[model samples]
Target: MKKVAIQGGGGSNHEIAAKAYFETDNIATVECNSFEELFSTLKEDHSIYGIIAIENTLVGSILQNYTLLKDSGMVIIGEYKLRIKHQLLALPGERLEDIREVHSHPMALAQCSDFFKQYPHIKMISRDDTALSGKWIRDNQLKGMAAIAPALAAEKYNLDIIAKDIETNKRNFTRFLIISHKEKIALEDILTQQPINKSSLVFALPHAEGSLSKVLSILAFYNINLSKIQSLPVVGSEWEYLFYIDLVFEDYKRYQQSLNAIRPLTRNLKSLGEYHVGKRSFDTVSNDNKPLSEQKTF
Candidate 1:
């Protein structure tokens, strides 16, 4: 069986991907308690695949995961976008009025802040995983206690959904990336090709007026389109910023040339990674191919 190491407890978002990507009978799910555990497992297990939550519509970017991916050598093999549905789950026969404390992961609690505000008397406790929180509340049989987690988690833990779609924003989505220790193949290898809609790079610009303009001009010169630009505080530097950019390039060669041209204008330039422009989707396996259970490692 192919073992996939996923972030958070067994019933978290990562398991959703595992179910979508690999056959259940041939897949082994490894639960990681924290980001640290996830990274360590990735380093130790060469054959293991990982699904990490990169960003969410309601909660914003997962900055820590971004840093982890930036520093790690693992290649992003695929991505999956899961629609987040937050549920207020509690122990059996527990009513909303009976709930005094609600526990969940920080992000989950944040996303449901508005809902929680309605019950000002209820105390909010942040835990590691939303699903794990639900499990804890269930296992402990804590009356007047609930958790914010996905419906799958509620089903797995046999908790009742006291409230549904409790997020402040109705359009909640979380983008996850599937990473592998195996080397990434050239872009040409993927058959369902899409236009290179987004290009990401990290760079430090020279501290001078028009320096930023000059860097941007390189993209303009090549007719490269930029989608988003975010400036993050540069570590150990006071008032200086490291710029992260996302661009839409017509072609890879043009993107490369644009990057090459900007090299001299910036103090430092590095391509973090490149992915095709599109919403997340899963890979399809041929029916005739051997199941993961029958496959042998070299």
Candidate 2:
């Protein structure tokens, strides 16, 4: 049996992906309430792998998860994308007009702000997970209270989907990364056989004129492509910043050459390791599709 640890609050999205990816009957799923709990769960259960949400199309990058990845010892072995469909669920027979209060995760609530605006009289309450809110509503049997979650959640908890596709954006997607205590030897071997498509690094440059520009120019000198760059505030140092960069190159040799060239331009440089961008296969599913009644819950 393969034991996998997953972020539990948001919904069964992470758990569903894990089950689908592994496709094994001998799988044990462990739920973590928060990022902290997820990491700790990974540490305590060395046999389990961690599946985490890294970025969302509507809400932008999950910055905190990036930081956690940078600081933690976990390795990013794989990734999968899941389309999010937010549903407004309430007790059976409850109408939209009967709902006076809505609850869901902060991100879910924010994503569906436009939907909630129609009912200005209703109070919006933020909870940890969309499914959790649905379960709470079901348990309490609150007639005027509803939850913004997945249609599967409403079905699992015996709630009614009063509204569907409530997210502000129609094309909502979330990228999830699979982390494991045991690094994937097969992935590394495959990456080494070919060229590394993406490389990630973290560095701190001296606060000086053109320091940042010089670092960027070094990559351009080697003709490396910069895919993404984000800056995070340095802890304990007021106003100081650390830049995290993702670069794509034609081959590993060129990537190494670029790294060697840029090393001298920055004060502190750390290679957060490199891995080929895995195939994004989940994007084929249409985001507009609603969950079927037989949807499985974690």
Candidate 3:
């Protein structure tokens, strides 16, 4: 049984993503309070894997996480995109009207801000983790308090979901990266188990005219699709930036050739990882706002 590090409680989205991406039921979780702890855990124990949420459709990129990945010596072995569905959960026998305060992570609160517009009397509070808030409410036997978290969190803490799908966007999704020590991500196994279709790269170019455009042209010539590109300012280098790009290609050989052709054109270019792209899939969790008893997994 493999032990994975997640940046939250047992029922967090990171745990959910780690389970789904690895497709294992026996794996155990080592919960970390922060991303820095997650990376350090992996550094100390090369055998342990990690899952970290990198971006969300509604919140955009987590810039700090991007910087962490660049500095950390972890390798991206795979990815998972989980549909984010926020449920308002409270103690059993408690209805929505009985709830006077709702607690959740700041991002969760922001995502479900529109839903609370109708309930002006209810106070909104931000906490460290969504699942932790639910656990706190349940363990403390707090009345008139609800938590905005995932259904899994409610189930874990034995709370009743009073409201379902409270997020402002129904199509909200978060992308998580499955990472591990470089040695643990064997290139041979990835090639055998999954076809490599996508890769992430970080590089900086000379401050010359058309430098970025020329790199884009080379990628296009090799039929590589640029799914995402983000630039972060380099430390101590005024105005210069490092470009991080996600490339998807149909042919692995072509992707290699493209890299070879463009290596000289780049400076300090780093191949983050090569793996199969992940798809966004909605889980069967009563999207129609049904009760917990009537809910089923999709």
Candidate 4:
């Protein structure tokens, strides 16, 4: 059984994505109140695995998580993209109008901003985790308080959906990274199971003219599709930045060649992961983001 450390409580999106990714395995989740705690848990026990939200299509990147993951020295073995649908959950007998305050992760609250704008009377309070907020209201039996969290959270905590799909955009999605201690993964089996088509990388470059452009040109020559690139300033380094990038390609050998071709130009270039692009094959997560069956597999 895989022991996965997830951010937020049982029914949070992290947990949902975990189950969906590891669809056929008997895995256990260690609920963490924060991403920091999630990494700490993994560091303390290298046997445990982890899944974390890297970016949300609705709210953009979870910038802090990128830094944490970089510093954590954890390996990104896989990735999952979750379709997020936020719901306003409250006590069984409560109605939307009866709620005086809504609580959730800042991102969750922000995603549902338009819905809350319709209920200006309800105060929005930020919490560390989305599902945890609902769990707290249920545990405390708090009346007139609700949480904007996932639909699975309602089922987990026995909360009522005061409002369903409350997010401002119906087309919201969040991408999560599957991380593990290097020894915990059998890289051969993972890459061999499917075509290695995508990669995540982190690196820094010398502050030289056209240094970034040179790297991009090499990748282009090798036909590597630069799926995404994010830059964060290096602390105490004058005008230097760490680039976090995602690359996609049809040929694994060509991908490696691309990396090698540009490796000399980049400083401290680290390959975070090389895996399959998340798509229909991992669609076990239903419309409500619930597991289709109790079967264990990732």
Candidate 5:
């Protein structure tokens, strides 16, 4: 069985995304209590793969994960963008009206904030994992407790769905990165799955005016589209920053040329990955429905 490491329990979004990306149910989930533990597990077991939530539409980015991914030295084999739909789950016998306290991850709670406003009686408590909260309620047989988690958690933990699709916005989604040890996954193996058209990179440029602009100009000149770009500070380097970017392109040769052209302008240029961009998924609609992620170029 394929072993996938994720940051949470069986029914969490991380596991859900892994299943969708791998397109297989015949796998074992290695759940970790924290992201640190997840990376540590991968470090110890190179054969194990990891799925992580990098950014969410409702909020912004999970900044710490960028640092983790950068320092882990893991290869991004693939990516999956999951539409987040948080369900309210409770014990089998408990009704929504009977619930006095609702627990979930802080991010989930924030997404469903509008739903909670209608029921002032229920107090929102932030926990480490949404799926774990449901398990706790089920195992303890808590009557007055409910958990804001995915629908899969209800089935996995024997909880009933007290509510469904409680998120305030329908566009809420989280982008997950599938990563593995550099040696375990060959580039040819990933190529067989799909043609690569996207690349994620991180580089530090000289702290001078127009230095960053020059790199971007080179990419545009080569027909490369910028998908996402993020900047973080370089430790111990005063006022200096590290640039992390995701570039997408249709022409492979031009993409290669763009990288070579920018090498002279960038220092410590490293590729996070070069892989196929994932299809946009909005509430499981797939390709039939128009999704937002496909509409943007930069």
Candidate 6:
């Protein structure tokens, strides 16, 4: 009976990731029309958890959400990397030839751009949510319109899959972060509950040259591996930047030591969260040769 808040409606990839991370089919969703609402919902109801897409392999980091996460004071408890397979779905009884317009999230439309090239007559329309497009088409019994979304959306919205894996790159993936109220959940408690090998951190460096390099050297000396690093310009300060990084480590104590070692070198060092690096479940191979999107349970 776990209730989680997602940025999109039911059958959205956020909900899909939540189910995978929580490992439950019974989790209820508090759907928010937008990401801003998603965080606000959690603030109003501390008991409700939240899942949000942080980054995608095809697209870059969601920079705005980083600011939201930091400002909202939510703690990242877990993460999930979902393989994004875009499917073209239409209302039942409609064929691909009958569809003239395809609707989806902008990113999804971009991913399936190559697939639509064959049908230049079909126009691509961007929407706020991929699954919402499907739900809209279904609930309204719309015709001649299709949605580019996950297969789950097709199933959930009772849409016929006109096409499967339409994304230009079969390797597309989106990394989602699971968050909760900081006061409601303790970092130590989450660390004990899960095998935390990965951590996200944000910090500001001194203006001096090699200041960032010094911090990197210290982490390398501690046997920490930098998986991802992103730099966002500081708004008020011209030419100043804040660094957000993802680190993976084998030894928890060594990782802790690395953080302590870098604190002196960083101006505002903050450990965003420490959680297990999400496994790519959609990359699994089945003996029957079925697609990973079809084989995945959730």
Q: Give me the candidate number with maximum TM-score.
A: 5
Q: Which candidate do you rate higher for TM-score, 4 or 5?
A: 5
TM-score of each: 0.80, 0.80, 0.89, 0.89, 0.92, 0.91
Model 5 CA RMSD to the hidden true structure, in angstroms? 2.3
RMSD in angstroms between candidate 2 and the native structure over all alpha carbons:
6.4
Q: Is candidate 1 or candidate 6 better by lDDT?
A: 6
Residue-level lDDT tens digits of model 2 in 110-168? 99999878889999998878788898888888889999987767877889999978888
State the TM-score for model 5. Answer: 0.92
**Residue lDDT tens for model 6, 129-201:** 9999999999899999999988888889899999878889876778899999887686336667767788889
Give per-residue CA lDDT, model 4, range 1-298, as digits (tens).
8899999888899888898788753679999878899899998898898999999776788888987887886888878777788899999999988999999988888888888888889999999989989999999999999998899899999999988888778667788898987766674356577777788888898889998999998998988887788778878986588898888888888999888999999888888777777641233333554331221121
- Which residue pairs come into collision in candidate 4? 23-297, 24-296, 24-297, 25-296, 25-297
- How close is each model in CA RMSD to the real structure? 8.3, 6.4, 5.7, 5.2, 2.3, 4.5
lDDT per residue as tens, model 3, 42-126: 9999889888888898888888887788899988878888889899989988999999999989999999999999999999998
Q: In model 1, what is the error at residue 138, expressed in angstroms?
A: 2.7
**Cα lDDT of model 5 by residue, 38-99, tens digit:** 98999999889999999987677788888888898687888898898899999987888899
lDDT of each: 0.74, 0.75, 0.85, 0.83, 0.88, 0.85
Best candidate (score: lDDT): 5
Which of the predicted structures, 2 or 4, would earn the higher lDDT when compared with the native? 4
Worst 10 residues of 3 by lDDT: 289-298
Candidate 1, residue 121: the lDDT equals: 99
Following a full C-alpha superposition, what root-mean-square deviation does model 1 have from the true structure?
8.3
Which regions of candidate 3 fall more than 4 Å away from where they truly are? 187-191, 234-236, 283-298
